[model samples]
Target: MATAAQKPLTGAKVFLMLVAFFGLVIGVNVTMMKLAIATLPGTEVDSAYSASLAYEKEIMAAREQAARKWQVEARIQRQGDGGAVVQLEARDANGRPMTGLTFKGTLERPIDKRADLPVELSEVGIGIYRGSASAVAPGQWDLVIEADARGQRMFQSRNRVILN
Candidate 1:
């Protein structure tokens, strides 16, 4: 008897083999993409940190420049009548009178609410603005001055004066 001829590989077998091979290749490609991305350097992260540092420096410089532009020198002089006169010496960046600037003063006694006094800008000198109010008692007083110059609130200072 003649032996049965071995069947040739079918088309379905060849197609399945091709599908499996392509599937494995696709999986390997996906894995390599993930690894490449994971190993990449984070240049954007470093740039963001550097940008924040630059912004902080810019803000600090702006604040410093504003402080330098609008400055106030204040003092309290003892009047001859046992009262203290609060003086605010206002100056611009070039040490000139910031004219047409409004000034407000609040004098509060350390112990008495009845002695709270408010004064406005009454005298404007060459480079000074003066506001005078009588002190009721001889003790510490809080002098709060607010100034507006060139549409900017440039000066706000609190000073303690001892009436002796």
Candidate 2:
């Protein structure tokens, strides 16, 4: 039988036991936190990169849809006189004519100092726009055409027109 003189657990031993239990709990908590962080997706550079990739895909899809919905074609030929004729054909995806579309054309000659011409398209027929004025002494002129249709902007292939 234990005697009354036998002291209870000393203060030093109780303090040491408490410290050990707290240290073990802290260690386990830290380990769990590390594992969670490793498995979860972080809001850092990787997240930003993924978002940008999605945005680029959306933009590309919109561009392709616009191209298929609207069609713009151009032709340049010599007139009976010394002037030139510039004709444009605009159509929808279904090959139907698109009418009442605004058109703008610019003829630029970088080599020549005074050869820049800008003209508005005239309505000729269904989905057809024509320019009456001839290019001024055209030599490697860049012909630009712009149009607005269905809330989308359509442009023609930059044609290098040669006036002979």
Q: TM-score of model 2 relative to the true fold?
A: 0.52
- Structural similarity to truth (TM-score) of each candidate: 0.51, 0.52
lDDT of each: 0.73, 0.73
Model 2 alpha-carbon drift over 4 Å, by segment: 1-66, 149-152
Clashes of each: 0, 0
Residue pairs with backbone atoms closer than 3 Å in model 2 (clashes):
none
What tens-digit string does per-residue lDDT give for candidate 2 at 60-111? Answer: 7567757678777888776766455678998888899888877878776655
Worst 10 residues of 2 by lDDT: 37-46
| Candidate 2 lDDT score at position 15 | 100
- Identify the leading candidate in terms of TM-score: 2
Which lDDT value does model 2 have at 159?
A: 71
